[model samples]
Target: MNTDIILTCAVTGAGDTPPKNPNVPVTPRAIADDCVAAARAGASIAHVHVRDPETGAHRHDTAYFAEIVDRVRDSDTDIVLNFTAGGGGDLIPELIGTADDDRQIRAAAGSDLQTPSERHAPIGELLPEICTLDCGSLNFGNAVYLNTADWLREHAALVRDAGVKPELECFDLGHVWFARQLIDEGLIAGDPLFQLCLGIPWGAEADPATLLAMRDKLPVNAHWAAFAIGRMQMPMVAQAMIAGGHCRVGLEDNLYLSRGVKADNAELVAKAVDIIQALGGDVATPAATRETLGLRGAP
Candidate 1:
């Protein structure tokens, strides 16, 4: 088992979950605050996704990212920042017209497709220590997360050039396969970092066997973390640590501290820390995590 592990708290996701739980951080200020709190509660890193401050909808605007980055940087907390470069890939086909044309397919109400350059703009500008590179496309719920191989290659190159580490988010085995190819093509430098995302609908199931299979396929020297959404979040924490991988927890992946308890980011992180300690494994601090992941230090 990997005794030393980096614990990341995904502060807020791009999903419409704020209505379900009031503690979910929406504004840049709230996100930055929660990230600092997570760091104080023993989270080595904070994986962030910005949303519309007013509407609470997910957005890729560089300005929103800039404010969030600045707030975190100006704080005393020493948490490593991992921004979400994984947005703008949501394709809502149900919102499209029945015109039998490519434009009809593109003309969806919730279709939030963006070019690779658009996705990389915030990360490239703000320069977080690490940003996510969602490895491949999958049937995400009712919509499709359109991260094509070509788009991933382009996104990887952009992240590499921006001097930010790419946390490869792989939801399935094929995603890992394509990530390895990116490494082989020299788009990703140094030892790769991966996030084994499990339990999303239509993706890999949140089971021990599935996680192990995905873990076994990772490149040698890769630093990987794993997380499962919903009630399986805490169980996967122990499972991931036992399987010799790092762990991730927070409001992004889960909402409950227990069956009926709604949890904020810090509470979720603290719970993970408790689990790691109970398993006789120590959580890595920000400095240690940066060194382990070969990040350019805390930013």
Candidate 2:
């Protein structure tokens, strides 16, 4: 079992989950505050996704990202900020009838798609120490999360040129395969960092066997972490540490400290720290994590 662990807290996701929990951190200031709290609670990194303040909908506006980044940087607390560069790819399809009785498929009300450069805008401008590069597409709930191979190659090149580390987020085995291909193509620099995302609808399942299978498929020189959503979140943390990898936990992946107990980002991070200590492992600080992953440090 690996002893030293790099823990990440995904402060807020791009989902419509604010209504379900009041502590979801919608505004830029709230999200930045949560990131600082998570760092104090022992999180090495904070994975951030901004939402529209009024509507609580996910947005790709660089202004929102800038506000959050500024707040975090202005604070005295130190933590690695990982911005989400995986937005604007939601594709919810709908069929409509034409005047001539023909049918056509088009994006539905919830569909939000953008060109690669549009998606890369925030990362390119802000240039955080790390940003997410979702490896592949999958059936995400009722809609499809689309990320084609060509788009991925272009996105990878952009991240590499910016001198930022891309956290390869693999939702399935095929994603792991494609991530390896990106590494082989030399688009990914230094040691590759992977985040094995599990238990999200039609993606990889949350279980020890599934995690092990995906872990085995990773390149030997890769640095990786794993997380599972909902109730399996804490269980997977222990499993990841035991399997010789890092762990991630936050309101983005889970909202409850326990059954029927609501949790904020820092609480989830504290719980994960307790789990790491219980398993006889220590949590890695942001400085240590930067060294371990070869990050470019704070920007």
Candidate 3:
């Protein structure tokens, strides 16, 4: 069934994407600008992942999130902010020397490794309309994206109690199952929103059959969006819409607009907007998307 699709822009992912593409925004002002442009280009929700401006490293600072929210809210754009609470808890055991001498300090890339309370800080205070709840732990690429069940239950309840929507992020099939368990346990409130993450290594692959199977398993009355990483990114925009779901796209999932061409969050969002238009689908405004997803109004 074809419906009005909600486009999401994942502005800056917590990866080594900054150096790879100079267009990647590092400051809160730049990030908010990209988000406002994305919203103007048909995106209803902005999936934000902050980074350190000096080193271009990802950080889970509530102040950073608050500044972005303030900018977006103070602007004329009406895009819904979806701050990410999925960072932290990533533990990659050490292999320092022999098996007996494994004591690790830092793993590669950006792993804030924050506690549940710390993870919920941005969401609790900044209080975006929605924030991601990584459903289960998995190997995100070579790194282990860790979120224990106990931790998940605590985080879900916190989000529910805060009246913030949890956009369930499932890397694999098991993540989806655990997400359902949370719903059944009364941790996630109302009809949950899901983001079917695809094409990431050590998780679900980017295949039509795999995507369709995952789509089929969605809980009754749940809402979802899907995206494929790297080269398959553009193609999955069509795939997600055709599979009866919404779509997410931006520089975070992909950098190049085409071969050897660098792009920004706004360019990626415009491309997705064009594709959705050509596919005979209308994009939803923030107000429309809020009503569709049952998001509470922001003050």
- Measured by lDDT, the strongest candidate is 2
Candidate 1: where is the Cα deviation over 4 Å? 94-104
lDDT of 3 by residue, 1-299 (tens): 44689999999888888889988888998899889988887788999989887887788888899899889889978898899999886766544555656754555554448778899999998778999999998876666888999999999999999999999999899999999999999999999899999989888999899888888889879899999998899899999998899999998899989988998888888898888889999899899889999898732
- Candidate order by TM-score, decreasing, is 2, 1, 3
* CA lDDT of every candidate: 0.92, 0.94, 0.88
Candidate 1 local lDDT, 60-133, one digit each (tens): 88888888778887997889989999998999776355555743445368879899999999988788899999
lDDT of 2 by residue, 1-299 (tens): 88899999999998888988999999999999999999999999999999998998988888988998888889988899999999989999999997656988899998999878888999999999999999999999999999999999999999999999999999999999999999999999999999999999999999999999999999999999999999999999999999999999998888899999999999999999999999999999898988898888522
Candidate 1 vs candidate 2: the lDDT winner is 2
What's the true lDDT of residue 134 in model 3?
95
How much is the lDDT of residue 15 in candidate 3?
A: 86
Q: Which runs in model 2 stand beyond 4 Å of their true positions?
A: 98-101
The C-alpha stretches of model 3 lying farther than 4 A from their native spots are: 96-111
Q: Which candidate, 1 or 3, would have the higher TM-score against the true structure?
A: 1
